[model samples]
Structure formats: C-alpha cells, structure tokens
Target: DTAVSQTPKYLVTQMGNDKSIKCEQNLGHDTMYWYKQDSKKFLKIMFSYNNKELIINETVPNRFSPKSPDKAHLNLHINSLELGDSAVYFCASSQDADSPLHFGNGTRLTVT
Candidate 1:
C-alpha cells in the first residue's frame, strides 16, 4: 500500500483560477509537509504540520495556503493561480524531523 497519496494527479486550469490538492498519509507519521518542485526541478518546502498543528510555513505567496484538519491529512489550496504556479506539488511525511520522508507521486499543476 502507498504510504502517502494525493488526489488529482494532474490538474490543468486557466490563470486566476482557484484549485486544491488533497493529500493523506497512512504511515502513522507525526509530521506532514507540502513541497513544490519548480520547472528547474528544484524542490522547496511550502508548509509543514505536526499533529494537526502548523509548524513550518515557508516564504511562499499568500495565495498558497495549506490546511490540515487532522494529523494524517494535509491539503493545499491556491487562489488566483498564475502561470508561474505550474509545477509539481508533492506530499510527504516523516516520523520526525530527522526521519526519512515518504513522498506521494505528486500532483502536477498546469496553468494556462
């Protein structure tokens, strides 16, 4: 079974549209995160939640928001999407800050 999973593996939308990506982890991990991979393949952490509490919020735009209703789930919502928003969003989880991460396949977002 997959340790981490994300919905809508591929998403295509027009600029200014609002979109969301849902993620869940079954690894019984305490920390979950959202990372974005840019066109250059550089990955950056967007947000991190530990036990349903927000722990890390990176320097991303205000238009991008992460919501965690529970410890096992982390969802990302983007408003007023722009062409620059086209990238792969990955959901990951780890037992702790020093543990290895288990990542989902990723959700590719395309804005035209």
Candidate 2:
C-alpha cells in the first residue's frame, strides 16, 4: 500500500483554467501538507492540516486552496491558474509536525 497518493500525476492546461489535485494517505498520520516545488526546485509549504484544522502559510496566495476531508486525505484546488503556478505539487503526510514527511510522487502542473 502507498503511504501517500496524489492523483493526476501530470496536469497540462492553459492560463486562467482551474484544476484540482487529490491526495490520500494510508499511514494514519495526524498532519498532512501541500507543497509546491518551483522551477528552481525550491519546495515551499502552502498549507497544512492537523486533525482537520487548517494552517495556511502566510506567503501562499488565496488562489491556492487546500482542503482536508479527514486525517487521511488532503486535496488542492487552484483557480485562475497562472503561468507562474506551473510547478510540481507534492502531497505529504507525517505522524506529527515534528516527524518526517512521506511524499507522493507529485503532480506536475504545466500552464501554457
């Protein structure tokens, strides 16, 4: 079984389009997170959910939304996608905030 899984491993679309990526984990983790990896390979935390409570990083834009239905799932929604939004989105989970995160393969979104 996969510890973490994210759907649509690749996404290709034009600017202004809307898209969503789904994620699920079987590791029984308490905290799940969404991370964006930019072209330079910098991974930045966008949002984190602990037991269904949301914690958004201040630097993240409003266009990016993260929803966790339960402890095992976290989904990402992007509205009015921009060229700058093209990056690899990774879904990760950890037993707690201090534990190491196990990441999904990543969903690479490309905007034209």
Candidate 3:
C-alpha cells in the first residue's frame, strides 16, 4: 500500500474558483501535514494535525484550510484561488512530530 496518497495529481481552475485536495496515509502515523511549494520551489508547511487536532502555520493565508477527519487523513481546501496559488501541494505524514516525513507525490494546481 502507498504510504501517503493524494488525489487529483493535477488541478486547473479559474482564478476565483475554489478547490480541494484529498490526502490519506496508511503509515499509522500520528502527525499529518500540508505543505505548499511555490514556483521558486520553496516548500513551506501550511498546517499540521496531530491526533486530529489542527495547528495552523502563522504565515499561511486565511484562504487555506486544513481538515483532518482522522489521524490518517488530512485534506486541504482553498477558497477563492488566485494566480499566486499556482504550485504543488504536498501531503506528508510522520510517525511523530520529530520524525522524518513521508510525502505524497504532490498535486499540481494551476489557477489561470
């Protein structure tokens, strides 16, 4: 089984449209995270969930939301997408907060 999986490896939408990406992990990890990689390839953590409790990163915009229905799943929702939101979104899971992370292949989002 895949350690981490994300759906819709590619997404293209209008600038003002909203979309969501789904993620799931079977590694039995306790912590899950959502990461965004900008065009410059700078990766930043947007949100973290431990045992289904949310912890948002201060730098993330209010338009981004992370929802964890359970410890093994973390989903990302973007509202009113912008051209600047065009990038790859990654879903990752770690055994613990301090352990190395296992990332999904990533979803490429394009807002035209």
Local distance difference test, each candidate: 0.96, 0.92, 0.92
Model 3 lDDT per residue over 1-112, tens place: 9899999899999998989999999999999999989999999988888899886565888999888888889999999999999999999999987899999999999999
Tens-digit per-residue lDDT, 1-112, candidate 1:
7889999899999999999999999999999999999999999999999998889999999999999998899999999999999999999999999999999999999999
Candidate 2 lDDT, 1-112, residue by residue in tens: 9889999999999999999999999999999999999999999988889988896564888898888888899999999999999999999999997899999999999999
TM-scores for every candidate against the unseen true structure: 0.98, 0.96, 0.96
RMSD of 1: 0.6
Collision count of model 2: 0
Residue 91, candidate 2: Cα error in Å is 0.6
What range of 10 consecutive residues in model 2 has the weakest lDDT sum?
A: 52-61
> Of the pair 1 and 2, which is ahead by lDDT?
1
lDDT of 2 at 94: 91
Clashes of 1: 0
